[model samples]
Target: MDSYDIIIVGGGPGGLTAGIYAGRQGTKNLILDKDLAGGIGREVPEMENYPGYENISGLKLTEIMKTQAEKNTEIHEFENVLNIEKNDDGFTVKTDKNEYLTKTVILATGSSHSHLNVPGEEEFLGRGVSYCATCDGLFFQSRDIIMVGGGNSALQEAIYLKNLGCNVTIVHRRDEFRAQKHLQNMVKAEGISVIYNATVEEIKGDMIVESVVLKDTKTEELSEMKTDGVFISVGYIPHTELAVQLGVNLDETGHIIVDKEQKTNVEYVYAIGDVCVGLKQWVVACGEGAVAATSAYHDIKQG
Candidate 1:
C-alpha cells in the first residue's frame, strides 16, 4: 500500500494548489482526481478576475497549475475515490484503482452543475439539453438556443455561444443578473436576447429539443418559445458524499464546514475550494488550498 504525509482528494485548482504547497513543505503528498485534474474549472470559457493575468481561459489556467503541482507532488487522474476511513495511525483513501494511507487528508472534491429538474430535461439530455457550452456549443452552431441562469457562468456561456453563431438567448429567473458588470456588458454588446424574471417550465421536443415552456415569475404567465437546444447554467451543487462518509461536518447547503485554516471538525482532515462554504472562485480556492496545506504540515510536524 502506498503511504504519504498528505493525500488531497481532488485535482482542481484547490487540490493542485494544496499539492504544490504540501510538497514545498517537504511533505510527501499525492493528488487523486476522478476525472481530469481541472474539475469544473475547465468549463470556464474565460476568466478576467484572477490576479496576475489580465485575461485567460480556465482550461489554460488550471493546466498551468496542474503542471506546477506535478513538479512537486504525485497526481493521479481518472482515479475515482470510493471511500475514506480513519485509522489509529492515519487515514486510508480507497479509490477504484487502489488504496493508500496518509497522515492527513484534504478534501477538495469541488462541485457539480445543478439541474432544473423540469420535465423533458432528463429525456433530452444528449438530444439537445446540455450544461456546458464549451463542450457542446459547436453542436448548436448557426442554430437557436436558450441559456438558463443569470450568474457569471450563465452570461459567460451565453456570450460564448453567441460568438459561435448560435443565436443565444438568456432566460434568467431573476430580474437582475448576478454576474459581473463586465460580463453583463459583454452580453449586451453581443446583442444576445435576455428574458428576465423567467424560468424554464418545461423543455419540449420529440427526439431532440424543439422548444421550451417558460413561465414569467411576476406575471405567472406561461409561454413557449421555439429553440434547437437548452443550455442550463443555473449553478452548482457541492460534492459532499465523500465528506459525509468521512464524518466531516457540512453546512445546510451541503458544503464542507471549515475553519480559517481550512481545517474541518475532524482533526487530521481539511477541506477547501467549492466543496467548502466560501466564494467559488479560482483565486479563493487556491488561497484556501495553500492554507490547508500549511495547516496539515504544522499538524504533521507537531506530531
Candidate 2:
C-alpha cells in the first residue's frame, strides 16, 4: 500500500484547502474523496459572500481551490473510504476500490441537507430549487421564493434574500418559531411573509420551480403558492459514517468532537468543517481546514 504523511478524506473545501496547506509544508499529503472536490458548495448556484470578490459561483470557487490543491498533493478520485483502522504507527484507510496508509487523516467530508423527501423536491433540485441561500438567492432576484424552516438560518436568509430584491416567504411546520427571539422579530420587522403550521406537500413546475402545494398542519388543507425558487434550510445530517466506523468520539449532535485545533481524540487523526461539532459555513470550513493542517504539521514536526 502506498503511504503518505497524511491521507485526507473528502475533497470539498475543507479537504482541498487542507491539502494545499499540508502540501505547502512539504508533507506528502494525499486526498481521497467519494465525491468531487467541491462538495455542497459546488452544487450551489451562486456564492456572493465567500470573500475576495463581490461574488463568485460555487462551482467556480471550487474549481479554483481544486486547481490549487491538485498542484500541492496527490489526489485519488472516485473512491469512497469504507473503513479506517489504526496500527502502532500511522493509520489504514480502506475504500471500496483501494487502501491507503498515512500518519494523519483529516475528515472533511462535510454533511448532507435534511431532504424534504416530498414529491417533486428531488425532481426540482437545481431547477429553481436549492439549499444554500447565500449560494442561490441571487438567481431569484425580484421573484418570489419560498424558504422552508423558521430557524435563525432560515429566517435570517429570508431577510437576506429580501434585501437581494426577492419576495421572501417563510414556511414552518409549527405555528411558533424555534429561532432566537430577536431574529423572529427581525423577520417580522422586515415584512417577510410567514406561513405557520404549514408544510410543503409538493413542488410543481413545468421547466423550473413555479409553485408549491403547502398543507396546513391543523386543517390538513392544501393550497398552492406561486414562487420562482425554493430554499430548504430545515436541517442537515453530518457525513460521519467513516468517523463512526473508526471509533472517533462524536458529540451528542453526532458531529465529530474536535479540539480547538480541529484534532480529534484519536492520535494523528483530525476532523474539520461541518462534520465536526461547531459552526458550519463556507468561511468557517476554510478556517477549520487551515487549523487542522497547521495542527497536524506541528504534531508531526514534534514527533
Candidate 3:
C-alpha cells in the first residue's frame, strides 16, 4: 500500500487541473483513471470554446494539461477504483490492482454516453453502433451514418464526419437543437441533414448495421432508414455510483452535491466536474477542480 496527500479519481480535465493546482502547492497527489487519461473530452475533434486556444482538439488539450500536471503529480492510468472508505486517519482508495491512502480524495469521474435502449442496439454495439465518433468515424468513411442527439457533441461530431466525406443524418427527440448556435449553423452549412421529433425504435442488421428504425414523436409513426452506423450522443449519465456508495450527498438526478468550495458532505471528500451538479463544460469542470484543490490545500494546512 502507498499513501499520498491527495488522491483524485478520474483523469478528465477536472482531475488533471486539480493535480496541477495541488502539485504547485507542494501537495503530494496521485490521479487514477480507468482507461485513457483524457476522458470523453478526448473524443471531440475540435474544441473552440476552451479559453486561450482558438481551435484545438480535445486530445491536444488534454495532453498539454497532463504534461504540466505531471511536473508535480503522479498519474496512474488504466486503474479502475473499486471502492473508497473513510477512516479515522484519512481515506483508503481501493482499485482493481492496488490500494492507497490519502488525506483527501477528489471525485472527478466524468459521465458516459447514453444509449437509446432500442432493440438490436446491444446486438450491433460494435458491429454498427458506437458512441464515439472520433474513434469510429473512420470505419464509416464515405458511407452514410445516423447521429442521435442534439447536443454540442452530436453536432460537432457530425461536422467531423461530414469533413471525412461521410453523409450524416442527425435524429433528435425535439424539433429544436440544444447545441450552441454556432455548432447548429456549422452543421447546416456542412449540409448535414436532420430528423427532428424522432426517436430510434431499433437497429436492424444482418451481421453489420443495415438500417435504423425511427418513430415520429408527434404522430407515433414508424419509418426505417438505411445507414451503415448509428452514433448515439443523446446525453450523459454521471459516474457517481462510487460516490453514492461512499455516502456522498447527491441530487435527484444522481449528480454529487457540492458547495461553492467543491466540498462534499463527507469530510475530506470533494466532487467536481461532470459528476457534480452544474453545467457540464470543460471550462466549468476545470474551474471546480481548481477550487477543490485550493480548498483541500488550505484545509490540510489548517490541520
The residue-by-residue lDDT of candidate 2 on 1-303, one tens digit each, is: 988888889888888889999999999999898877777777554454578967666779899999999999988878888988988678888899988888888999788889899988989999988888777878889898999997766876787788899999999999899877877887889999998999999999998998999999999999999989999988789999988877899989999999899988888889988898876678888888888998999998898
State in Å the error of residue 225, model 2: 5.0
For candidate 1, write residues 1-303 as lDDT tens digits: 999999999999999999999999999999999999999999898888999999898899988999999999999999999999999899999999999999999999999999999999999998999999889999999999999999989998999899888999999998899999999999989999999999999999998999999999999999999999999998899999989988899999889999998999999999999999989899999999999999999999998
**Cα displacement (Å) at residue 35, model 2:** 1.4
- Candidates in order have lDDT scores of 0.94, 0.86, 0.93
* lDDT score, candidate 3, position 243: 94
Q: Give the backbone clash total of model 3.
A: 0
Which residue ranges in model 2 land beyond 4 Å of their true spot?
A: 117-145, 150-170, 174-197, 201-213, 217-231
Give the clash count for model 2: 0
Report how far residue 61 has shifted in candidate 2, in Å: 1.5
For model 2, the local distance difference test gives 0.86
- Between candidates 1 and 2, the TM-score winner: 1
Backbone clash pairs for candidate 3 read none
